[model samples]
Every structure is written in C-alpha cells, then in structure tokens.
Target: MVTAAADPTPQTADAQPWGRVDDDGTVSVREGDDWRVVGQFPDGPPEEALAYYERKYSDLASEVTLLEVRHRRGGASAADLRSAAKAVSAKINGASAVGDLASLDARVAALTETLSAETETEAAAAREAVDEAVKVRTELVEKAEALAARDPRTVQWKQASAELSTLFNEWQSQQQNGPRLPKSTAQQLWKRFRDARATVDKHRREFYAELDEAHKEVRDRKTRLVEKAEALAPKGEEGIAAYRELLDQWKTAGRAGKKADDALWARFKAAGDALYGARSERETADAEASREKIAAKRELLEEAKAVPDERDLAKARALLTGIQRRWDEVGRIFPREAERGLDDDLRKIEQSLRTREDADWKRNDPEQKARANDMTRQLTEAIEKLEDELAAAEKSGDKASIAKASEALEARRGWLRALGG
Candidate 1:
C-alpha cells in the first residue's frame, strides 16, 4: 500500500487524494501505513468514488460542530452532552473522513471539560436556590402558624382571616413559580401550613358561632321590646311617658345582626312614632281649645302690668289682690308652654307689687317712725348751728365762710324735710 509512498497530499474532491482507484475499479482509503479497500465503484469515475466517501466525512464533521454548538449554548444537559461527545469522538477516531479527524476529537474533549465545570456550577446554584426557597417557604409557614397561635378572642377575626387567605395565595404562587424544595421538606412545610389554616378556620367558625348565639339572644330581647312598645301605642298621648320609658329600655337593648336589628328597629320606632304622633295631635287640639283661655290670660297680664307701675302702695296692693283672684279664674292653658310663659309674666308683676307693699309697710312701722323723728331732730340741730355760722360769716364779710355755711344749711334742711319734719 506504500507504493512510491502513497499519496500523503491533502485530500480534495477532484484529486481523490485520501483514496485511489484500482484498474479494476476497486477503491481504497489511505489508513496510516496501509491502504484499506473501502468499496467498489466499477461504474463511476475515480473522483465520484472518493467524493461519495468525502460526503460521509463532511457529515461526521457537521455532527461534531453541531454538538459543540449545543454545548456552548447549553442547549443540552451536561450528561447528554458528554454522551454525545463520546459518540462523536468514536465516529471521528476512525471516521471515513479525509479532513482533520484528530482536531475534531480534541474539540470534543475540550467540550467535555467545559461541560463538567458548567454542570458543577449549575448544580451548586440550583441547590442554593432550593435552600433559599425552603427558607422562604418556611418563613411563610411560621407566619401562618403564629397567626393560628393567636388568642382567638383577641384576634380581629376579619383582618386575621384576610391575612390567612393572603398567605395561602402566596404559598400557592411560590409552589408554582419558586424553586422546588426537597420532597420531604416540601411536604412537611405544606402539612404545617395546612394545619395552621385549618386551625384558623376552626377558630373563625367558633367565634362566629358564639356571635350568632349572642345575636340571636339580642334579637329575641328586641322582639319582646318591640311587642311591649307596640302595646303602648293604643293608649294615645296618655302613653307618651310610658313609651319614653320603653325608649330608654330600647337604647339599653343590645344589638342583633344588622339586618335583623334594622328591621326590628323600624317596627319599634314606628310604635314610638305612633305615641309621639298622638302627642302631637293632642297638643294641636289643646292649643286650639285653649285659644280663649290664652286670650283671657293675656288680658289679665295686661291688667297686672299696672301693678308694677302703681304709685299708690295701697291701691297697687288692692289691684294685685283683685288680679290674683281673676288669674285663678282664667283656668289652665294648654300645651303648657304658653301657660308657663303667661304665668311667669303675671308673677313678675305680682312680685313688683309685693316689693312696693313691703316698702310701704317698712315706712309705717312704729320703730321706723321713731328712727325718722330722731334723724330729723339731729338734722334740725345741725341746720341751726349752720345758720348761726352763716350769720356770723355774713356779719364779718367772710365770703368763703358764708358760701360753705350756706351749702351746709341747705343740705341739712333738705334732710329734715325728707324725714317729714
């Protein structure tokens, strides 16, 4: 096969350099130091015979390039790439190709080393992500567990329930989108979360159950209150005080459910409305019936007004006494408001007359008369002394002394006259 050193030139399609054609059309490919028979191409030319096998070598080189591309792009798993690289290496080692087969094997080997490092790094990252995900999921579970551990009575049920629901939604989202944790850890965390949720659910049910019972009791109480309030409605305006008492009771009555309370209150308030309505109607009737009495009282108030203006104490007393007698005769006014106003007006007039009468009585007292006489005597003596001083000042032509004496005498005389001296 080493005839004159077999063609060691680079293979080409036309030269068929990696192969030769025998006279009998037997083709042989150059393999190391020997020529190995490949196939017979009795009907084709030498170039065609070698070109057919050259196409095979091209196909093999293409496979190696594709594998390298896949490895570079991370399009296949590391293990899958390794397996593929081995297969391609085997194909290239003794491949029917006439191109650089050794170089292709070297490229596959480099790809295997690269894939090993990449696989290790990716595995570490994936493990870290899983651990972090477990930590986050564990935190969520702990939060839910803490919520479940809260005192049921103190927990604001509405807010707690909303938070629990939000936690559940977050758990589902993490499960679907976050890194997958180990099966055992995942199942354990899920069980804990589910139990916490179940505990919250149970507490919620129990809390609402107690509230419903309390609400039912309140409803029954309000229902009875409503019946009692309605019973008072038949008594008309006379029952207004009783209805007011029932109203106080209604205020003290605890709450039922919203719908029930609203409905029951409507009925109870209607009963109260009936009582108030009766009172309003009665007031209207009384106001109409009291029209003449109001007029009579107004006339009396006008007559009594003179009592405060009376100059004669005895006459004012006589007039007030007559007015009081007639005021009683005028009878009661209705709606009471107008009655109170008119009575107040008349009483003020009477009080004025009484005050004047009291003054008069004080003036007529024997002790008062004695005191006045004594005062008049003292003033008379003081005036006599002042007159003497004025005369002396006039005789002496002392003008300042005369003026001062005159003023003092005049003041003393005025006091004496005021005492009815």
Candidate 2:
C-alpha cells in the first residue's frame, strides 16, 4: 500500500491528466501515471475543456464546500473566492441587468427633468401674480393719495373721498397679501367697491343740493333782517336798541356759502353802522349838555362845603340834603368829566365833615376808635378775598365766572365804602 506524500504534489498523484483538441473540434484527454504523459488532441471545445478540468478535479465540490465551511467557521478567509464568484456572476448576468438599470435611470432622469420644468412654470406664474398685485396696489395707492389731498372743510365731499380711499386701500392690500379667492369672490368685491363709490357720489350730490337750499334760506333770512334794520334806523334810542337786537340775531345765524356770507355781513354791518352813527351823534350832544349841568352842581357842592362851622346840626344836614338833591337832578355827565366832577365835590364835603366828626369823637369816647379799627380790618380781609376770587375768575377764562366774581367784588367794595374809610 502507498501512503499519500507529505507534500501532496500533483506530480506525484495516481494520475496526471492533460487536455488536448481532436480533429473534430472536440477535446480529448490523456492520463499521466507516475508523471509520464500519454495522449494529446488536435482541437479542444469549450465543454471538453471544462470536462477535462472536472475529471482531474473530481473532489472540487467537496474542497469548495470545505473552504466555505472553513471561512464560515473563521478558520480561513474566503474574501478572494467570494470576489471571484461575484465577478463571474456579473459577467454572466451583466447584459440583461444593464437594460433594466438603464431604463430605470432614464425614467429617473425624465422625472427630474419634468419636476424642474414644473417648478420653473410655477415660479413664472407666481411672478405674474405678484406683478398683477403690485399693479393693483400702485393704482389703489395713487387713488388714495389723491383722495387724501382733498380739503377736510368740505365735510360731505371729504368724508366720501376718505371712505373711498380707505376702501381702495383695503381692497388693494387684500388683493396683494390676503388669501386667494375665486372669480366669484373677485366679482363680489368689485361690485361692492363700485356700489360704495356710487353711493358716496349720490350722497355727495344730495348733500350739495341740501347745502344750496340751506344757503338760500340763510340769504332770505339775512335779507329780511337787513330790511328791518334799515326801516328802524331813524328812530332814536328805540331804533338803536332794536338794531342791536338784530345784530345779535345775525350773529346767531348759521354760516352760508362764502359769497353769501360776505355779502350779508357787509350789508348788515353797513346798516348797523349808519343807524348807530346817528344815535352816537345825538348822545354826544346830550352828554355835552349834561356836563354843563354837572359843572353847576359842582359849584353848588363847593358852596355847601363852605358852610361855616355851627352848633345847628339840623340846618347843616338840611343844606347837605338839598345839595345832594340838586346833584341827582343834574343827571348823567359826560363819561370823561363825570368821575372828576363827582370825586372833587364829594372829597371837599367829606373832608369838612370828617374834620368836624373827628373833633366830636375825640371829645366823646375812645370806644369809637376801637369800633372803626375792627371794621377796617374786616373790610381789608373782605377786599383781599374778593381780589383773589377775581384773579381766579380771570385765570379760568369763563365769562360767567368772571361776572359772578365782579358782583362779589362790588358787594365787598360796598361794605368797605359803608365803613366810611
């Protein structure tokens, strides 16, 4: 029996088989025993070539299986064999597989191209939408600016213009940035905008008509008042008072159109000036006469003041009463001379009597001095309070408050005057 060599060389195997090609284009095989060649072939077919390799390596399957097992068990690495197997598989199936892969890649490329084209189309549509919105916004902004420039004093026109302007702004802003609505919504919005504008225009026309009617009424009323004033102008004090009343009524009347207001005011002022001018002339003549009478009374007052000191107090009082009656009978003096005339007369008489009274009081009692001092202090406080009230009234800028304060000041002054200080 022969033992397998320690090296297991193929040269020392039981048979050494070699392959050759036959004349028929088929492969033939020969065997070598103990390393001696036996046969050759004329031609070798691919299958015969494969068969020759198979027979010589009859235990190839088991060797491959053992190798895979060893690789699995981690006894040896099968990386190179696995790579070779994959390469063989790729070569066998590569042609058929490439057609499907190429078709899938083409489909993916087509999908990418389609998506890019759609994106571009969408972008262009968005740009168009934005441009349209901008146009609407610009138009609305111009309209609103024009409306805002209108005069606010024209109440109805201004209000209508403002409302239209606001609506336009709202509509434009909504179109630009608000939700996208359907055609019906757009139609409804447009209709609303049109109807609102129409309504405003109609209302404005109506307002102007009413304003015209009102102006006519004002003109008629003012014309009647002017006629009444002209009729009453010749009557003396009665005419003056009546004309003043009419002036007051005119002031209370509401405003008319600019031309009518100016015309009416001019007419009213002219008529009033003519009437008052005549009355003023008459008053001046009367005042001059009254001044002459006041001068005579002032001479009489001087005479009364010159009355010699006497024990007959009753006769002195009677003469003073007569002088006061004469002063009263003299009536009003000219405003400029009145104050001086009264003050000079009263001061002379008061100084004379005050001297006599002081002498008399000194002869009688010290209690009278105390009473006068108390009265003086009370009057002074009252006057101070009155001045404060007047100052406060002026600060408030109220006619009614100032009037009330004036009355209080007068009352306080009356008290002071009665104190004979």
Candidate 3:
C-alpha cells in the first residue's frame, strides 16, 4: 500500500531548457523570468553541465513525487505527510535543479492543504472514540458501585465478585486496545471502581466472619446434644423419651457448615438409632412372650363364631357375653397389629350379632307389630278402593283410569307383602 510520489512528464536533458552553461562554463537555473547562477562547470561542455545540474533536479523531483504517492495511497498519516512536505519544500527553494521547481512547490502546497483537512477529520474521529471509551468505562464503574451499594445480607457474594472480575477484565482490555481516555477521567473512574471493589470485599469478609462465629456456636451446641444422646444408649428403651426431647432441640439448631454438619448428623442419628434399636429388641421379646396369648385370643374368636348360629337371640347374647368375658381374661397380645386385627374380627362378629338381635327385637316387638298391622290394614283398604276403581274404569272403557288404578293396586300389594300382612 506504499506509494511513490506523483510522476511528472518525462524530459531528456537534450530537450530540457531549464538549465544552461555559459561560455565560462558557469551553470545557471531559470527562475521565472530571471536565471540564477547555480555552479561553475568550465571543464565540461554545456550539454554535460546541463546534464549534471538536471540530474540534481531529477533527485528533488523524485522526492516530491514520492510524497504525492504516499498521500494518495493513504499509507502514511496526514501529520507524517505534512512533515515530509515541509522538508521537501525547503529543499526545493533556490536549488541548482533544472526541472519544474514551481510545479513541485505547488504540489507540496496542495498536499499540505489536503493533509490539514485530513488531520481535522482524524482528530474528530479520535475524540469521538475516546468519548465512547470513557462512557463504557464509566458505565462499568457505575455497575461496580451499584454492586457495592447492595446489602451484604441480600447479595450473593460469589456471583457479585465474579461480575466485578469480569468488569475489571473488560476495563483492562479497553485500556490496552480501545481509544485513549483523559488522565483525570481515567483516574477518577478507577478510584470509584477500586472503592466499590474494596467495599464489596470488606462486606464479604465481615459477613463470613459473623457467619463463622454463628456456625461455631451451632456446631458446639449440636456437639453437646450429640454427646447427651450418645450417653443415653446405656438406658436401653427407657432412654427414648430423653432422646425425643433432644431430637426436638436438634430441629432448632442452625447450620454447622456442610462437612461438619454431615459428620455430626451421622453421629447424632447413630445415637438415635441405638436408642430405637433397644426398643425394637424389647418389642421383639414382648412379641415372643405374647405368642401363646395371641393363640388363646384366636381360639376364643373361633368359639364366639357360634354365637351367631343360635336361633334364640337371648341364648346368642348369653353365649357372646361369656365369650367376651373370657376374651378379656386371655390377656393382651404383643405386636399390637395382630391384636388390632383380632379385635376387629371380634368386633365384626359382635356387630353381626347385635344386628341380628336388633332385627329379632323388631320382629317380636308388640309396638312395631302393631304399627305394621295398622299400616297393612290401611293398605288393604287402599287396595280394595283401587280394585273397585279398576273394575269400574274397565266397564266404562276408560283405559287411562284403569291403568292408574292398576298401578296403585300393585304398589299397595307390594307394601302389604313387605309387612307380612
């Protein structure tokens, strides 16, 4: 992308008229309407002298042309081009050159003008970029400040710290790669960020410090609770009530950190398990001792089954009463589930007998029988009336009335049958 200076129209020394050698072999270069003496070349022909001086002009021209190409190619900064133009223009003035020196001066001037405009545009763009970078950094600083303002109790320290780290990294990247910021602005933003970060760190440390103290308190309390629980293992099943009270105390105990809590819980639960284990062994012994009692109760249940078979309610009641008294004498069974099941079975038999006795009482009760007979008599009267209506309706050829009467009669007969009247 590097460019050479602008090329001028090519001219050979023979056709070139910008330089000449006098009879004394003195060389002079044309400057506008007048000519200026450049050097003496007495030992050479006019052609040689002109040629030699014209070569110097060619060198100057090349330098100007190189500047033009550099500007056009955009490979050099405007400032750099401006500086190079200034140096070349100085050399162009009053030189012993034979080419178009005026044209070179004009080109250098134009190049400077172009560079000045480009310099302003570049400066404006750089300022915009710097402003944007400042804004970005300021926003990051504000975010850090926001985080610092949050209540330590409410803030999740892990996530907050991570966000701060990310912001810091972004700030670094912008400092190194993005547009430069003003020193005061950059320093101000950094101070704000540093204060915010320091606040957050201080809060985190204080919060955890308080938490550690609280954890130690809870851990010690639980440790004591566990020791008391373990001490109860020698009491066997009798220690269960004390263990339950300790378990209640454990419910209100706060966290003791994960590892310590888990270890302590294992010990505490083991103590409770020991207490329950003793109870279980005693229960098993009780169950074994009550096996005979359980068998006796089952036998009584079988004997009581005969109570329902008796035709006389009084005799059934007497038999069930005797069986129930004997059942109580047989004593309680262990593994209470077996006892509950047997009791349920006996209760069902009792319920059945009670139901049968109730039914028998209703069948034999004089008041109930009297009521039934009264109802039967009323139904009989209703049936007689309906039958009369049916016969009359049939004789009159009134099919609707006949159907109604027949329905009433059928219903009344069903009721009478139910009453055994």
Best by TM-score: 3
lDDT of each model, Cα atoms only?
0.82, 0.60, 0.86
Tens digit of per-residue lDDT, candidate 1, span 145-249: 999999899999989989999999999999999988889999999999999999999999999999899999989999998899899977988887887887788
Candidate number with greatest lDDT: 3
Per-residue alpha-carbon lDDT of candidate 3 for residues 1-421, written as tens digits (9 for 90 to 100): 1111222434434444566667888887666767788888888667777777778888988898899888888877787889889999899988877666787788889888989999888889889999999999999999999999999999888898899899989989998999878899989998998999899899999989988999999999999999999999999889999999999999999898898899999999999999899989989999999999999998988998898788888898899999899999988888999999999999998999999978988998999989998998999999999999999999999999999999989999999999986
Q: What is the lDDT of residue 383 in candidate 2?
A: 83
lDDT of 2 by residue, 1-421 (tens): 1111111223323433233334443433332222212223235544444354334333333333443454446532233434433443343222211012222233334434444555566667766775676456445545544444444446568666676867676886777775464566467556655664565566667778888998898888888888888788567556878888998888877777899899878888887788778868877887867768777766876768645454565566667668777777766666656757676766677567667766776646768777877888987898898789888989989789889889988887888787676
Off by over 4 Å in 2: 1-157, 162-186, 248-254, 304-312, 325-331, 336-421
Backbone clashes under 3 angstroms, per model = 0, 5, 3
Choose 1 or 3, whichever is better by lDDT.
Answer: 3
What RMSD value applies to candidate 3?
6.1
Model 2's C-alpha root-mean-square deviation from the true structure amounts to 24.7
lDDT score for residue 350 of model 2? 59
Instruction: In angstroms, give how far residue 387 of model 2 lies from its true place.
Output: 51
| Model 1: how far residue 142 lies from native, Å | 2.3
